[model samples]
Target: MTDDYILVLYYSRHGATAEMARHIARGVEMHGVEARLRTVPAVSADCEALSDSIPAQGAPYASLDDLKNCAGLALGSPTRFGNMAAPLKYFLDGTSNLWLTGSLVGKPAGVFTSTASLHGGQESTLLSMLLPLLHHGMLVAGLPYSESALVETHGGGTPYGASHHAGADGKRALDEHEITLCRALGQRLATIALKLGNDRGPNR
Candidate 1:
């Protein structure tokens, strides 16, 4: 079997969430595991919705194979009315096959999000994304008090996962605490995946 790798998957509309994904990937790599960054395409409102086969920029489109093969997962998105955006949700809804096959069972998973405002539902959105992973029987991970950034963050880091206050203009960058937490979440997940992977042996 292939070695361990953490899949950092996300859908970024204004880029903040994508940046957070990068930070999380950095954290994963710091723990000596490969970080695979992937993103989903946007959906159109037209009755016949479609997206390009390859994304114009940023990470390439993710496939079910990526999800099934990943050693761990870090899902990210922007908040939409206290829920994950539809594009991310749409991509996840297609993972039922992985769920049915139990391909993702026992893997470690985490969630992150960015919001236009401080009170714009960052935590709730992260929680919403975790539900599907839970149903897939993945081990859910969240930031803990050991991460000092959680207490210092005025912008977005939370126990649920890393988040960013993108502001109304969507131009504000992630603060130091947000960055620290993002990395912490990535490291935490990778560490867990490594331990679990070692226990499962080469057959897994």
Candidate 2:
């Protein structure tokens, strides 16, 4: 079995979602677990388009092994018309092998997102990301009301998951509340993953 680690996987266009991923990773580590950060390459209109073997910068491209071995997952995306971006959707679409093997069953998972506006479908985007995780039989984790940021955030924070309002130009940094909620979600997932791992034994 792979070492205990929560996979922090995401695609960021304007950098907000990536930043949120970083914060979430920190929270995961704070709970005494490793956080493996990975990302998917953007898709293109060309049917034969291909990216280089490795990304130019940022996190490494995720492989099926990464997903198969993770103890938990944190999925993030920049909202595209109230949905996850095509690249992430495309990556999940290719995980049929893992699903067929029941690799992700019972693992905890969470979602996060960033949008250009306060009402730019953050909840819908979060819900859309959760669909595949649910299909894989993963336990879905969401930010609870106990995280005060969910109730107090003026910028972006949701019970559905962590979120940030990136502003019209996509430059607004994550506000304090948003950051707190992001970390809270990550910590929650990690804690649950650890408990589940303990219950299942080291070989799981």
Candidate 3:
């Protein structure tokens, strides 16, 4: 566990959200910070953690320490009918312990998402993901209009957060505009995290 990193946390079914997370991580590094990419395991019908101690591919399963000790966070997920996917939500629900101790207070955070259609609740999903960070007392930030990709995007990009409009079949590769915004979101979080670092000591 590291206290000097931004945690890039997300859940992806068709890989779009995971792809976005990678881009965000790149942006975080661009801002001269380490980015810890992490994911949650899928849950069973009763919401129990799936048997594996770690995921077979992509990022490893995120520990509570990942969330608790992060300097900042970038949460991403595939859209679940205008909300975050259940796996991501399930992981957040376990953070009540961190909330009680205010471990996440004053940390900067951002969100990103992928949707199956152009109107498939991208903004809503982004907003939905932010709710948990807000409750954790994180200082959540969204992309500012200063980023030109927000105005030129035909794919998925929102002032609310970074997003990708995966085609209905879920095969649409991220367009340049969507990629830009994802990196922008990551950069924003990293920048804010560094500025806030001096004012706040390590929560861990």
Which one wins on lDDT? 2
Estimate, for each residue in 1-204, the C-alpha lDDT of model 1 and write its tens digit: 147689999999989999999999999999889999999888868632366788778899999898888899999999999999988898998988887888888889999999998999988899999999999988999999988889888999889888999999999988888999999999999999988965543324
Give one digit per residue, the lDDT tens place, for model 2 in 104-158.
8889999999999999999999999999999998999999898888888999988
Worst 10 residues of 2 by lDDT: 195-204
TM-score of 1: 0.95
lDDT of 3 by residue, 1-204 (tens): 224999999998889899999999999999889999999888868758764897778899999998887889999999988999988998899999999999999999999999988999989898998888898888989999999999999999998899998998999999999999999999999899888866776563
Off by over 4 Å in 1: 47-50, 198-203
TM, every model: 0.95, 0.95, 0.95
| Clashes per candidate (backbone, < 3 Å) | 0, 0, 0
What would the TM-score be for candidate 2 when compared with the true structure?
A: 0.95
How large an RMSD does model 3 have? Answer: 1.7
In model 3, where is the ten-residue run with the lowest total lDDT? 195-204
Error of 2 at 173 (Å): 0.4
Off by over 4 Å in 2: 47-50, 198-203
Ranking by TM-score: 3, 2, 1
